[model samples]
Target: MSISRRNFAIGLSALTLTACNSTLGTTSNSGAPKPKGLPADLRPHLNRDYAAWVASFRNRALSQGITESTLNAAFRDTGYLPGVIKRDRNQTEFTRTLEDYLSIAASDERISKGRAAFTRHRSTLEKLEQSYGVDAEIICAIWGLESYYGDRKGDIPVISATSTLAFDGRRGSFYEKQLIAALKILQNGDITPSRMTGSWAGAMGHTQFIPTSYQSFAVDYTGDGRRDIWSDDPSDALASTAAYLKRSGWTRGTKWGRELAAGETASRVLQPQAGGPRFAVTGNFNAIKRYNNSDSYAIGVGHLSDRIAGAGPLRTPFPPDKYGLTKDDRIALQSRLTSNGYDTGGADGVLGPKSRAAIADYQRSLGLDPSGDPSQQLLQTLS
Candidate 1:
């Protein structure tokens, strides 16, 4: 999941801290140093360093043809965001089986909301489908998965998030490119710097386009001279997603994929979990992967779109997940965990990292392996 959806869905694993080479003392490479007298008043020094870095970056943006006005506006109050680094390093909450992922990604509630959104934007979706030759439902599914049909279009400032990641130096070069691309977007006047907000990793808009992806694929489909994906109106966002799919070799009038029953002649079958549902994916499935690059994510988009378009659930039954527990058992386990002081977030029944951490904590108390894999025996033990 390399897309914004992936960035948001997957955790950043651990917080990444770079060596700040300012006049202030460098963070210790060894154990915490003894109190080395009164710590220097390093705030001003660090502030100046950050300001200088921003100035240098602004110069680079200028060299790349971003207007001085855009750079100035985008960086007016630019400062390092430590929270962005924390979130960027956050690992996913839970490891999920395909079934578990589907339970959340293509759940009934999501599908219902998706249908409503689809109906609300039917005219616009149809026109985009006709123009781009990509299915309307797929676009809607991408929108739903990326930002919950525009209901959760993220809140982190794009400039701060990207710049902090660039400064952090963990993935410095990649994030630097994103930062530059974001400035280019500002220069293009697609959105005001004040409104250029997105996920902590800088995936922006309803469809979660990273700055570079937006540069390559975003479109001003609304003809308003601005490819405004940040607006409440999702017309441009949806249309941009359609354009991306179309350009990614989306086949006109072909299904993204079909659920393959046992013995079905499938060109390519992907069964992420043993004994779980299998799918015969098409080129369109690959096209969706170009959006997020996760097999589970691509399937979620394809299956959710199929559901929104009135297709039935997969006839093939999914086995218990890797934890050897079914979906209902997982829900019960979450409820028990929360009630037992583990606080598995909510009983939404998706086993993300939080739920697993809770489970691991409980396991540790009992001297268990702390693998955090839920089993019927663990549920009974908790009971």
Candidate 2:
């Protein structure tokens, strides 16, 4: 649900469309005007089969002790979202090298923003750390990575998104469980249905806790009788993340890990990239991984937290990639390609889809095969 393991690139476009409608009926059932600025696929359309599915699901909701009033409010403006299904089915499965992961995770912009956010909320974060026994820097790092310090908390309605996934049935049982938990959250008066917005997959709030995780770990740190993570004030969400880490067995006073120098040894060492830096990790590293189950993710969080705490970058350099290019070379390639009229989005040292397309375009211009691959030769050619 944290999405750290899936793709580190946050989709800024989706975050811009928060004003889109959430109900199944665009203009009939609620008589609300059709939502503007939303993609057609994301808008709800009439589907009798989906209607029947919801009708049957209501019985199950009732059996689970969800009151009739809660069900009605939760489902009032909710509807099947085709875009959610599309996104679920078409998830891009790819791996990022530890170097690239760290580049994005601790990029100059993220580090700068993180420092400001940490400074702004230092008191709250430190208090949460004090209470939960989790490190404050770690909490800030998760917030930085999860929602860019609350800049991109998703806008899709959770009930609609969860119910659509539940009806789609590909991961029906899993989503059904989420839908039920969401309803329970609604029944608990933590958030209203209209305000219960989150990611397309139902990951919500500052740290993107899925409903089940929220039920288990979320806290009302504000003491307002509501565990409100969706609001601009991130006290509750930050506290919840600390609580989650505490629950996940974060050891107090233990470092997550540190990069090992040449000839350095430790009780447990991890070299995610074979020829890159080796890390001496602790139980706290595993605790970070419990938030997102990936070695790269754990390293990203640890390294970013360290950076936020004023540490320098890794001392050792990573070997050239399979394409025989280094991070600097990749960044140069992207910068050159963009200057040549083919945009690679930004020179982030990551050859993602836009970068690859730019490379392919440059290759075609040279009467070469458009393989969209990067190489030392290609970098030289661009130079």
Candidate 3:
């Protein structure tokens, strides 16, 4: 995903932040309510203005060389997904500290899953590394982060998603371009419109490539005629990611970076968190950034890659957050809260919305201010 599209997905919901894809489907365009098994926010909402916008967009798409047949097939069942617009507009600006990011990105579960995925796909990944000169673990790490190793390759139809965003007009031009690219992909017979499902932002497949990126970098590594990334097999998606990284200047043999031990020095060093561990990075680090363009994202990929390759967690501890709660303290707070009949949604140490809501409920029950901030004071109170 492009930085703008990826950032647009941030903070809308925990699912959007942590998982790029959902298996939910939208309601049909027939104006009949159907049980789609989707959350209310994710269900399609009818809008006349959206209909009008799509009508106008059809002309523009045709002018841009999208075939009429392709347009009709793509839009036959597609409708304006208000949930997509809600996700786009409701993105919070909160930036996670590197500590919080790593805690989620390289969590024990994610690391374990990455290793299993790497092993499961070892033959394919090693071949990709040989063919593309990008690290197999790096590709696997990207897969883990993008769509949870293909567990959540999303189920939202791409035409509906991209067209809805293009009509919403927040980042109209960009999404319009993406919409056109998606149409092109459809016209090229890679996949049918119904099978072309992806994230709400139209980032598709195991590695979550937006339509434009897919057009530029997606490949048919399976030797199949189609560049099918949304399939049960992840070979094409993984190969596409490797190709993207190689084209983005990944050095053939250099490591992305490593957590710097005491007395270690490098020409380039990054300390994304003030008192967190520093990393010695290489040009390959920049290459990883070209995929997502966030220091934390790149570090998360590199660190997760290292963990998948049998490396351990960072030795240095992160300083306490602004609320004076270290990661362990936060984890304990969450664990205690959950035990006390409040669901903090698992003690991952990152006090996300669910944990905060649980904390606020606990505080309110005691007639304390419902400020959701976690602190040592709160930890002690819970104790």
Candidate 4:
């Protein structure tokens, strides 16, 4: 089984951080409701209604064996976060092309950092792979992607962020449950609430495990009697990620997947975009997907791992997107569209919503399907 929708931090972190965003809603792709629930009209976090909800939730936490000390410590400075709600609501609705995604996910800088991390942690990482059957380079790749080799674990307070999301009533149920799991972690003394900082969506520590996922997969690799993922040491976090992949059915010593040549074929070839680069994935690729369901994310991790392990870039060129516009072509097309009274945002060479709208409007003028799909024919026609 693959990692659930809630565990896709790799995909979620790529948003542009626009102020006005739409919430992912209380339900995710699996149609499961996220955890939440406070009075309907209470929007700002840490208000009276939110406080009341927290009080009520405390009872539930106690029922789950979270201690009083843990609750107090967690809720002491915990308050509602409107900023988190903005991020939750403002997530990009569309997926990026695999090439676009990997530009950041496995960029030159990230790859370099991944190699450094691999070198620095080789001893511990090799032992982890030996114990868990998950590749050490793959672990470094995840660590690099999640926290930039532990340089950028987020600083948002986990209790406040998760509680705010829970009380906000959008993905409230999911956040609520994560908040509870967080409390359990605190109760177990694995990490203090003060140090339980992470992303707005509750993904924490160097490996960016969501709270519930942390509970399920985190281990005390340092043998310190606690699973401390928030500390400076990334051993526990990396080990936990390896453990996650191991349990998700990672195949020992197998490559995650290989990028295909122009005319190559494999039994499980996955070509996400028709003209883009293709891959012949293995069960290990599927195992990577168990960490994040998106093909781009799995491919990013797999490719980055390979790169860190001294592999080269993709062998084949990924033709143009379905748009039939290469990145440079898209920039030129956008310039043409603007001259033709169809304003795409800024000719950034990426087809975002504004670009699509412009394409759609242009298509409408041409008496076409108005599907907003760019093609060579459309580019030629515009020319």
Local distance difference test, per candidate?
0.75, 0.82, 0.85, 0.77
lDDT of 2 at 109: 83
The C-alpha stretches of model 2 lying farther than 4 A from their native spots are 1-29, 33-37
- Report the Cα lDDT for candidate 4: 0.77
Q: Give TM-scores for every candidate, taking all chains together and pairing residue i with residue i.
A: 0.82, 0.92, 0.94, 0.77
On a 0 to 100 scale, what is the lDDT of residue 125 in model 2? Answer: 90
Pairs of residues clashing in candidate 3:
none
Tens digit per residue, CA lDDT, model 4, 238-298: 8999899999899898988888887888899998766778889999988887777778878
Candidate achieving higher TM-score, 2 or 4: 2
Please provide, for model 3 over 195-309, each residue's C-alpha lDDT reduced to its tens digit, 9 standing for 90 to 100. 8988888888898888888988999998879999999999999999999999999999899988888778899999989988999999999898887778888899999999999
Q: Candidate 4: where are CA atoms >4 Å away?
A: 1-5, 8-11, 15-46, 321-383
Residue 181, model 1: lDDT of 91
- What TM-score number comes out for model 4? 0.77
For model 1, the superposed segments whose C-alpha errors exceed 4 Å read 1-46, 92-95, 336-342, 357-373, 381-383
Poorly placed runs, candidate 3 (over 4 Å) = 1-21, 25-27, 31-35
Candidate ranking (TM-score, best to worst): 3, 2, 1, 4
Better of 2 and 4 by lDDT: 2
Error of 4 at 311 (Å): 1.1
Across 39-144, the per-residue lDDT of candidate 2 in tens digits comes to 6666665677888999999999999999999999898866777888887877655667889888877888889989999999999999887898999999999888
lDDT of 4 at 46: 33
